[model samples]
Target: MAPLTSASDENTHQTLLNTLDIYSAPKPFRNASWKPPQRRNKNTKAILADAARKESSQVTTANSGTSTPAADTAPPNIAQAAQRLDRLVLEKSLIAPGPAVTYTNIEAAPSLRPERTRHYCDVTGLVAPYTDPKTRLRYHNVEVFNLIRTMGSAATEGYLEARGAHTVLK
Candidate 1:
C-alpha cells in the first residue's frame, strides 16, 4: 500500500499579506479598560447621583427601623445585596485583631489546603497554566482561550456549572 501525502490545494491559495481581526481589535485594544460607549455624563452625573442617593436613603430608612437580630443575620434587600453592604448591620463586618493563619490537618482551620491540584482546563480537561480573568476560566492553551472567548454567556455558564462554580441566587 502506498502512503497518501501532499493533500493541500496550491492553486486556490490566498495570499496572507494581512490578517483581519474578527473582533476588529488586537488583544490589548480588545482587553482595554476603557469601553467605546463611555459617556462623560457631564449633564447627568448630578441628576443620577441624586436619584441614587434618594433611592438608597428610602431603602435604608424603610429597613433600618425594623432591624431585629434574626433579620440582621439574613441577607438584606436587592440593592444592599448587590453592593454587599448594609449600614444597619455593621457588627459582623469588622476585622478581628489578628493576622490570618493557615493550619494543615486541622479540621477547624479557616484556611485548609486542597487534597490535590485542581488547576484543570475548563474546555480541554488538561493541565491549565493560564486563566482568563474576565471569565475566571482556566484554559490549557491559546486555542482553548479562543474557543472560550467565542462561547456565549449561557455556554460559559454551563461549563462553570459543570465545575460546581456557578452562582445560585435565592
Candidate 2:
C-alpha cells in the first residue's frame, strides 16, 4: 500500500474550506421583472367627485328644512347615543329586579379559592423543598440557595418582584 501524500490531503482540505466559505456567504439577489400595478387615476377622481356632489346635495336639503328619515332617527354624535342607550339598559335592569350577580360575588365563593399554595424555585423553576428566610426566596437545592445568597439586595428584590412578592411602600 502507498503512503498518504500531504499535497493531495492539503488540496482536499483547501477544497472543503472553499466549499464552506461559499455556503457561508450570503446569496445574490434574483433578477426578476416584478412591478406594482398602476392606479386608475381617472376612475378615482370621478368617484370622488360623485361623492362630493352627493354630500353637497344632502347639505342643501338639510339647510332647506327637509327632514330625512336617517337625519331624524340618528343622533348628532355616536358617544352621546351610546351613553343614552347604556342609561336605558341600566334603568330597565333596575326596574325589573333580578339576581344581581357580579364579579366580586363570584370571586368571594369558598370553592373558587385554592386549598394550598405551590412553592417553586426562583432560579431553576423546580419544586422547592427549602426556603431562605432572609430573602424569602424558594430554592430546589444548595446550589440555588448559594446563588440567591451571593446575589445583591437589588438582584434579590428583582427576583422577588418577578414572582409578585416584593414589598412596596406608598
TM-score of each: 0.32, 0.34
> Which residues of candidate 2, in runs, are more than 4 Å off?
1-114
How do the residues 1-170 of candidate 1 rate in per-residue lDDT, one tens digit apiece? 32232434443232221234355445663565666785655544566567557765765566654443365466556875644446434522332222222222243434366686669998899999898988878899999999999999888889889988888669
- Per-residue accuracy of model 2 over 10-97 as CA lDDT, tens digit each: 6776676777696688756744676766874566456656755775575556544322224556678889888767866675555435
Candidate 1 segments exceeding 4 Å error: 1-116
Pick by TM-score: which candidate is best? 2
Q: Considering only N, C-alpha and C atoms within 3 Å, which residue pairs clash in candidate 1? A: none
Candidate 1 residue-pair clash tally: 0
Relative to the true structure, how large is the alpha-carbon lDDT of every model?
Answer: 0.64, 0.72
| Residue pairs in candidate 2 whose N, alpha carbon or C atoms collide under 3 angstroms | none
Worst 10 residues of 2 by lDDT: 99-108
